[model samples]
Target chain A: MSATATIYLLTAAAVFGIGVYGLLQARQILRQLLAINLMGGATFLLLITLGGGADGPPDPVPQAMVLTGIVIAVSATAFALALLVKLQDATGSSDLDPPDAE
Target chain B: MIALAMDAIIAIGLVWLALRTVRGANVFSAIIMFIVFGLIMSLAWARLHAPDLALAEAAIGAGITGALLLVTWRRLQVLEGSVPQVGAETRSLWLTLPTGLAAALLIAGLGWVALSLPAEPATAGELAWQRLPEMGVSNPVTGVLLGFRAYDTLLEMGVLLAAWLGAQVVASEHRPGALPGPAHEEVPLVGALLSLVVPISLLVAVYLLQAGGSAPGGAFQGGAVLAAGGVLLCLTGRLEAADQASLIERVVLILGLAVFSGVGLVMLPLGEPMLAMPGVWAIYLIETALLLSIALTLVLLFAAAPGLRRRL
Candidate 1:
């Protein structure tokens, strides 16, 4: 693999790990969403990096999939945000559980 | 040398900002960092020779998603006066340490396997590139999306539309007005800025849609740009939420799926395979429909409303 691919591949791994940690550690729904998005980014990076090398243009298939993934992420995120707002409205709290939960 | 340096910088930036984005001093700051991270990611995309992905990342990933997040944050604030921040869940060191070690091992394994995997000589990617000429779209990515993988694109549009519809079903009906944007008085320059920016964004959106067939731009990027224009109008108070969607609004919302599927299914009767683009013109037709639907869906999602209309 090219140095560029190696750099991003490792980065993608670390980023995914961090995202897992974030998801586990998060207290708010919004933070969890952010963490999820971070993981999504890592996956996209990994897919594209693996799709091509340093020498030539990347594969169009992965590029198209990643592009589609980006759109779906935003849609899911937007819908999740809307749900978050409503959750706040109905329950009067934005955290997954009440802030007092152990 | 400089290219490698830039790559390293972006990679490091992504890691650092990602860390901050998840566990910053506050959620608001985390959001800001995430937006920055997205912008840097676009740089990474460009460096990777995926200008198509780069444009989509900037406009949709950073621009639309960031705006949605900020607006959601504001709504949370307005509802509760303050969003509670509980610090990271406290856990025993015994548990945390072992889990951390496992995660490290997992990541190492993933990276190792991914890097070590042998490149297949004749992959789907190679096939797609080889078939690009027959697909009628000059751009391979466009060919893959609208030609080879039309099903995926159609499903993506369905997901976007469903998300918008889901948001409508889930949103509290109490707020008929657009979920509050930053308060802005109608300054004279605001109008002047709108006159210039809105039209320019519209023009750019169309340009992107046109260029997408043969170049990097496409329905998603163009739609996001157009949505940004709609967002600008919303922020400046030139648009307001409606209790229900107008007929035109509803029609435009479904145009992408309707037109795309219509064109695809029509192929079967003619003995052509499903979703086989009859020609470049069909791509243009579908992209325009997709551009309209995507732009409207995003604007509605950002607006968090069933519909929007001129402020008058």
Candidate 2:
């Protein structure tokens, strides 16, 4: 009910929406990666905010999970980027497929 | 009250930036924005009383992730003129608008529910708190990470190592051109800055690892501070990436996981719990190794170079 909590939640929602939008609109493989990362960031924010209390130590579980999530996200992102480079090298196109198809 | 308001505003700004990064017109700009967003999120975590998360997010999220993005962006730039194909599946207004609204509604509902939940007995946090004395650390988060829920942390490190291996498998033989080359004669101000920052980073990193047993600092924070030092050198062109990793570099990279696993495996025959570090000394030792490895891995990942070497 605090205005601060409301702001964090709303921002997180908007970020998720944009990530969804990017996943739809981006034509480049790299762009898609960015979108996915953005979505991940949004989720992290949501978790942290939700864990926060009006007057207590924040929920330790979500904080721990988010720490774990950040590591996972970076590792996965690095692997994905490496793969993207390889894919482009193997194929002439950085864009794997055209935007017309779902 | 003011602190809460400030934290809330910053958090909102971060989310807004995340959205902008995703939907931005220029891909490069979006990546930059995303890094900034990650940095702000680190601040938010600090405000929310999750210093461990703050440290990890800043290092892995903003630092390592940003490096990965920039490297990929550069590689894609090799194919000039032609735009990299993005996935073009557009959502209908009926789909997108509603989804957005629904997510908002869900988050708001969840937040309210969470706020309303009565603090009760038998909370898991309480259990962790109760057991902290046994873990030999005052920090509950550290206790959870290295004591109670240590399996998660162990698996998380595995994920990091696996990702590194995966990257190696997919690595391009044609090395990306190092943007900043080493300078023989130290430039004015730059050298002074390096002298100041590098030592400070090292101090902070060690302090973090040592303090983690009782405070917000830990291996992740320490590693990041170390990596920041590495990054400083890289930016100043004082460091160079080699075709092969040196013996020392390899040792540092493997040290953390090795010590941790070795201790755990060794203790198995001794009739001790797996990864149940014997004392605060073991915890510090394991953390030292982990901190070194984490720092090395992140720095190498950032440079996108197989091995880092001192500039001759």
Candidate 3:
């Protein structure tokens, strides 16, 4: 891999790890949504970096897929946020764990 | 040397922002950091020579997503009557440690596999490039999206529509309104800003749609740009959430998928494969429809409303 590509790939790995940690550790539903998006971003970076080589044009297939993925991620996030709003309205808390359970 | 240095800075920034977004003490701060991360990722995409992805990341990833997150955060605060402090919750170390370790292992494995791949393994990009002429689009990404992989694009539109419908279902009782911006709409220069920005955004969106045939723009990018205009209008209180979708709004919402599939399916009886657009005119037609649908869907999603209306 080229030096630039190699550096980005490593960054993706680290970002992915952070996303996993956040997903596991976040208490609030909104925070978890942010983490999920972070993971999606990392995955896109990984896919693009992998499709890249040392020389010519980068792969268009992964590019197309990533574009689609970005759109899909936004859609899912919006729906999740809508759900979060409804949950807060119904239950009076944004945290997944009930107040009594904590 | 400077290019490498720039790459290093962006990569480090991305990691740092990702870390802060996940681990920040406050939810609002984390959301801000996430938006910054998205902008930096767009820079990285530009450096990687994918301008199409860069534009999409900027508009959709950072612009729309950030707006959505901030809006939701505000709503949550209003619901609770105060800002919520999102502190780290205590968890069993045993479970946390193992999960973190496993995630680390997965990352390491992915990195190894990515780096170890053959330098020039045949990829769909190569094939797409070779067959670009058949698709009648100069941009390979556009060609692949509308030509070879039309099915994915088709399903993607379906996904967007479904998401909007789902949001409506969840918030059935609460009718969302214009986002809270300046308390007074009569603030000096607000009109000037709207006039300048909204028209320019519309112009840029149409230009992008036309340019997608030969450049780094497309239906998705153009649509997002157009949606940004609608979003700006909403933020400024020029547009208000309506109790029901206007007839035109409903038509535009389904225009993309309907036209795309309608045209493609019509081809099947003509002895061509499904979704095989007949010519350049057909491509433009589909992209225009797609652009309208995408823009309307995104704006609706951000508004969290079934429809929009002009604010009196």
Q: Identify the leading candidate in terms of TM-score.
A: 1
Ten residues in a row with the worst lDDT in model 2 chain B?
A: B83-92
Off by over 4 Å in 2: A1-7, A52-54, A96-102, B78-122, B176-186
The parts of candidate 3 lying over 4 Å away from their true place are: B82-106, B176-182
Of the two candidates 2 and 3, the one with more favorable DockQ, higher being better, is 3
DockQ of each: 0.68, 0.48, 0.66
Q: Over the stretch B1-312, how does candidate 3's per-residue lDDT look in tens digits?
A: 899999999999999999889878688999999999999999999988889999999999999999899988887877776645443453457866887788778778777776676766646788999999998889999998999999999999999999999988989475432355446748768789999999999999999999999999999999999999999898888897888899999999999999999989988988999999898898899999999999999999888888999889
Reference A-B contact fraction recovered by candidate 1: 0.75
lDDT of each: 0.88, 0.74, 0.88
By summed lDDT, the worst window of 10 consecutive residues in model 1 chain B runs over B82-91
Give per-candidate clash totals.
0, 8, 0
lDDT tens digits, residue span A2-101, model 3: 7998889888888888888888877788989999999999999988887783246888998999999999999999999999988888877888676767
Global Cα lDDT for candidate 1: 0.88
- Return the DockQ of model 3: 0.66
Question: Which prediction has more favorable lDDT, 2 or 3?
Answer: 3
Give the true-contact fraction for every prediction, in order: 0.75, 0.56, 0.73
Question: Residue B308 CA error for candidate 2 (Å)?
Answer: 1.9
Ranking by lDDT: 1, 3, 2
**i-RMSD of model 2 (Å, 1 decimal):** 3.9
